[model samples]
Target chain A: MATQTTDVGQAVGGAAKVGMPQLDFSTFSNQIFWLIITLVVIYFILSRIALPRIGGALADRAGTITNDLAEAEDLKSQALAAEEAYEKALADARAEAQNINVLMRAEIQGQLDEELAKADAQISGRTKEAAAELAEIRNAAKANVKVVAKAVAKEIVAALGGKADAKTVTAAVTERMKG
Target chain B: MATETHGEAEAGLVFHPMDQFQVTPLFGAGPVEWFTITNATLWMGLSILVIFVILVLGARGRALVPTRSQSIAELAYGFIYKMVEDVTGKDGVAYFPYIMTLFMFIVVANFLGLLPMAFTTTSHIAVTAVMAMAVFLAVTVLGFVKNGFGFLSVFWISSAPLILRPILALIEVISYFVRPVSHSIRLAGNMMAGHAVIKVFAAFAPLVLISTGIGLVVTPLSILAITAIYALEVLVSFIQAYVFAILTCVYLRDALHPHH
Candidate 1:
């Protein structure tokens, strides 16, 4: 304080002669003291309080960003897996639909083939019965014609008053029929 | 008083641009006492307060999503941290707070000085010199404490020819000691010159009345020059602070690894 007072007097007396106060030695110590105090206070505040909090905030933000990215990646992979499963399900459904179509076609074809076979069997049975009836009618008519021709021969013989053998006539008629 | 009237009668224009830098005792016209608070002290204190508000109160939320003030605080923190990490490497990280303090104080002081009628504390060599000297002393002490006598190898250029080694060493030693002077002067000089230029241009405003229509042309042009210089000074303010911090980091790097 004593030195400061002496310097204070020198500053006041020399103030008129000084060209630039910055060069004045009397005031430098005071400026230096304040500078030190300011710097020290700022250093403590920055180191102890401000810088650490800012650093923490930065680190926290970084961690959040990293976590969000990881979660997004996980969700993306999950979406891809779900898409793959959906495609698989779609393909299975398509295959099942195709299988059903093929089975229905085959069953319908089997039923159509069975109906055609039943109709053919009934037509063949009708055709065989008509052929058998025609054959029997022809046989009965031939026998009737043979019997009538013999009776007419015997009558003509009697009407001529001649002695004719019935057996011979019958034999002749039988021989003619054979030819 | 008669000389002033005579000077004005003769069309003489008087202006003292440097008078603005005078450090008068804030309370009285008397001599500045050791404990006497001056404009420099007030501005310096304001710089500190601003720093505190921005760094402390601004980041009070510490929210995951930062507010504007929080973002500003984070930006300043990240900017200086990255600069230190890049310039001085991991070894210099320990001194980050000191470097940060210097950068914040200087930048704040410079910007605050731009206010009309406000004093620029950093414009004085007395302020910058102490800061530079502190860095120099701390680095020098750290170098010795860490490297012992081996720190002296910083001056010895082993890569040189044996005959030229002593000459190179002497040059290196001279440059090494010149660090603080150049460091302090660079900031102080830059701030002082810019402010002085603006003041000089402003002084030309009143010369208009004496020079017929010349003042008309000079006044606007002077304002224009002041505007341009003020813009440049704003840039210089930030740059000088960055330069000071980066240079300190470089010096610290040397102290940490003196062999290189």
Candidate 2:
């Protein structure tokens, strides 16, 4: 019975061994060595080359931003100057127009006054000439009338003979003119 | 009937690829038997090749205004710069190359392992242990170079009272030795556990199919779990890489300043 149990035990142990895979360690050492080597090489590259370039790029970006901002400010100042000049020119033009209008109005008014004066002077001269002609005609008419009256008076006096007094002669002359 | 079922179940369980890749002796040689070119090695090689190509291509044009490749290179450099600055302050600039290289290498290796049929080197204790050991050795050497015998004072807790100095020194020494072990295990354990769980769930997918409608439901669920785990692994890979780099920086600090 003991011998039988031992055989059974051995059978069980053998069966157990069949299912299990053996472990391997050589692979572990190889893995460890290569991991170290790779890490070391990576360290070398990063330290020697990559980092400095990144730092330089960052600095360059900062410089570019600053330059762009300064350029923008300069353009703003130039725009402001242009705006000021434009406004000044507009104001000057407006002021010049006002001055021209004033000068033009004064010259127009002076010319109108001269024309009015010349027209008045010509009218006055014509009136004076007409007045003088009227005066001469009146004088001539009066003289002719006086002569006729005198002739008439002389005839009446001859006819009247003894009624040749001044008052009576005057009264006869007025009665003849009335008829 | 249950005993028979249990026996059959036990018999059906098989050793997986992960078990086969474990750090064990082959053919009864010794611990040295574990050394071999494996999936982990392949992934690591691929990682190096990829990084090398990217850097070489990125740097080739060298234009005054950056091209796309140059821009990518600059971005990577800038990223590392910020990381170093945050971790080590302005003095970190001097060590920027080392930390950046370390971060990229580990990140690529971790990401490569996520590919189908790829080996994760960071998943093995032996591999991660070796890396941590390298860092420890480098930092130790740097400490001695920079501070000479003064570095030995770091273990003594010089700020403590004289009475407590001896005890603090012993504790500090022990903690120092534990650094490499913890660092390696932190990365390796996370990777191994995550991958193992994924494999186990995947194996269940087909087994659940041996049943009828239940198998169909379980299989989809298993697949979904696998997908979720994959996403988590990707996240963990990045986190581990960051942790490793940050820890390396801390160690470098220790080297630069011994007492602190």
The residue-by-residue lDDT of candidate 2 on B93-161, one tens digit each, is: 787777777777777777887887666767777667877898899889988988999999878787889
lDDT of 1 by residue, A47-146 (tens): 9999998899999999999999999999999999999999999999999999999999999999999999999999999899988899889889878767
**Model 1, B8-78: lDDT tens per residue?**
63355444455556665677666666667777789889999999999999999999999999999999999
DockQ by candidate, in order: 0.43, 0.23
Return the TM-score for each candidate structure: 0.86, 0.67
10 residues in a row with least lDDT, candidate 2 chain B: B24-33
Clashes of 2: 6
Categorize the docking of model 1: acceptable
DockQ of 2: 0.23
What is the total number of backbone clashes in candidate 1? 1
